[model samples]
Target: ITAKGKPQISTMRVIYQPQQGVTIVQWQFEQSIGWLPWEKLGSIMNDKILGPMMEKNLDQLRRLIEAETSSL
Candidate 1:
């Protein structure tokens, strides 16, 4: 998804794969740094924000899956 009022921005793509007993969530980040000096901004945002957010989302998914599986 594109953000508001920004030309050079970052976007994320997510995919999920069902494994034998677990699900793998893949997060891909794409950043557009046209005419930028370095990739520091992109790296910092991924490391600080995206990484933690993905981790939390995965943890929540795991809990929900486990709860449903236990009920079945």
Candidate 2:
């Protein structure tokens, strides 16, 4: 999914492991920086920039899921 005014692609996947009785959710965001040298260099900091945001989002998702499931 593309966020408003954001030039990036986001993907989410849910995988269930019946044997392990667990589910795994994965999220990824990808942004393309042009082949310019500066852009290529900036790409190296992508994780440092986006990692905390991703973790926060995932934590919120987990809390929401747990709340809903607990109600059921």
Candidate 3:
């Protein structure tokens, strides 16, 4: 998806599976280091921002799912 006249792309795959009556989500993000031979920026982004952001988003997803499940 492109937004604001800017070009961007992500290499991520999300898989959903049910285990023991619960939903399990497996997510993988493929790293990209374009035009730069070094990976320092990618490493820092993953460690400092992307990692925590993903965790927080997953937590929010879980809570929303559980809330709706309980109401069902």
Candidate 4:
């Protein structure tokens, strides 16, 4: 629960798949909002709120992976 007394839940998944000779990485994020009217309304803004942050995080992860593998 948040300080506002609303329940919040989130999940993240990372998937790796090998196709031919290259590996692909994919991720998913999900959040559960409480059953309050305001919460439901606020859910509408979740994508706009979270998209940029998520993209930044993914870019960091990609850079880290590239740096780590460059020597191999």
Off by over 4 Å in 4: 4-6, 21-28, 34-37
List RMSD in Å for every model shown: 4.3, 3.9, 4.5, 2.9
In order of appearance, the predictions have TM-scores of 0.55, 0.71, 0.59, 0.61
Residue range 3-67, candidate 1, lDDT tens digits: 63444444444445556544555555555444554556665775787778877877897799789
Highest lDDT, which number? 2
Residues 4-68, candidate 2, lDDT per residue (tens digit)? 35377778999999999888999997877777897667666887788889999999999999999
- Residue 22 error for model 4, in Å? 4.8
lDDT tens string, model 4, 1-72? 667765665555655555654555555555568788977777768777877787888889889988999978
Clashing pairs for model 2 are none
The digit string of per-residue lDDT tens for model 3 on 1-72 reads 223343334444555555645456655454544555445575566668777787788789889989998999
Ranking by TM-score: 2, 4, 3, 1
lDDT, each prediction: 0.62, 0.82, 0.61, 0.70
lDDT for model 4: 0.70
Error of 2 at 45 (Å): 2.8
With a 3 Å backbone cut-off (N, CA, C), the pairs that clash in candidate 3 are none
The residue ranges of model 1 lying beyond 4 angstroms of the native Cα positions read: 1-22
Mark the regions of model 2 whose C-alpha exceeds 4 Å error after superposition: 1-7, 33-36
Question: lDDT, candidate 1, residue 57?
Answer: 78
Model 2 worst lDDT window (10 residues): 1-10
